[model samples]
Target: MSRTLVIGDIHGGLKALEQVLERAHVTTNDKLIFLGDFVDGWNDTPFVIDFLIDLDKTHNCVFIQGNHEEMLLRWLSEGHDNEEWRLHGGQSTVDVYGKIDADRVSAHINFLIKLNDYHLDDQNRLFVHAGFTNQKGVEYEYFKGMFCWDRTLWEAALSMDATLGRKDLFYPQRLALYEEIFIGHTPVTRIGYSVPVNRANVWNVDTGAAFKGRLTIMDVDTKEFWQSRPLPELYPDEKGRN
Candidate 1:
């Protein structure tokens, strides 16, 4: 049977992204879901976008909008840079693509603008760049920002006392809405894990590709995972966002 692979935040680490894909042995037959943050941090933001565009032509790929993508899109459309975005590696993206042609920049903007806030597959697995507020279903159209900016959902999952036999007694409906929930905004490295962290039914795959950790890809069904080399090793010449 074909497999479904969900990838974590990329953060412009093109080499790391490629390494993770190769480690996963991704094929056109398999479905790939990216939990966004494709740009910002590393120096190859434009190349990362181009690589995904090319991959989409051959493989079944789903791209979800991340907070970085959100800020980039806003800057592109509003003709002004977001200070917060720039402070968090957005300047690296701007520095790389600042002098590119108008058409190419526009293409990147178009791609980022079309990314989904979240995706639900046939098996009921939820894929999102960040956690969602509603357990039923996200009102993506009205509160799209939450889909890529919320941390409370992940915090709730982490704080849940799984020791309690009756999980329903404490926020039962929250994560019970889906078979599995995959997110990327909060890096696992922050909690000292160089690998994906699983709490409750939520899986955080972002192994901190922009930091000292590696990028990760996990099989939705089997829960097996693959990872790239450390981010610093992948880009020896540049000091990424840090």
Candidate 2:
């Protein structure tokens, strides 16, 4: 069986990432799929990015982009004063880099810009950062809403009762291309195992590590899951999330 270790949003939690990887027992042969939002929330973006870059050199790894990463890229490229981004743990990421030098900041933005929007494996599995979509072909923007939005699609998919049939409401393109789609954006109260939504299989590993929640990792082949609580200081207030 193909072993894929899918991890939830890291949010710059380097300790959590290390702990979860150890708990999940990720090996060299296994594919490590990070569900994005690797920066922000925690004050360790520099360390997290450095570690992930090093990790990529050693193993097969896929890093999907998330909305926060998108915003970061936009601000860095356009010289936008993003106080809103800063409010939502973006400042923490900035803190890690220590007042972004032009060259170093460009390097970081380049890394974020290069992240894949989605990953579709031949094993009927789809991996994305923020959300999932039924859109296909020309409709799929390589760096558009498919990567960072689509929570509405998720909720509609989950509200279904059956586990095998497709839910029409969830399909933006009215096509069921994936038998199982794993995503990280909406943090479920539970962690580890797959959470089924109608015929749409959602494995949200985000565990809200940046908001007083756990860090989650799941083995896609075996459906095994692992979790660990986040540091209290990393917790965000309700308003902070806005």
Using lDDT as the measure, which candidate wins? 1
Q: Over the stretch 27-66, how does candidate 2's per-residue lDDT look in tens digits?
A: 8889989888887877777778778888988989998988
Return the TM-score for candidate 1, rounded to 2 decimals: 0.95
The sequence of per-residue lDDT tens digits that candidate 1 reaches over residues 1-242 is 58999999999999999998998888889999999998999998989999998899999999999999988888877777777888788988888887778898889888987899899888888898887776666743356678999998799888888764334667557577777889999988888899889888889999998888899999988889999999899899888876
Weakest lDDT window of 10 consecutive positions for candidate 1: 163-172
lDDT of each: 0.87, 0.70
Please state the error at residue 123 of candidate 2 in Å.
1.0
Task: Give stretches of model 2 more than 4 Å off.
Answer: 99-103, 132-143, 167-175, 190-199, 233-242
Query: How displaced is residue 124 in candidate 1, in Å?
Result: 1.2
**Residue pair clashes in candidate 2:** none
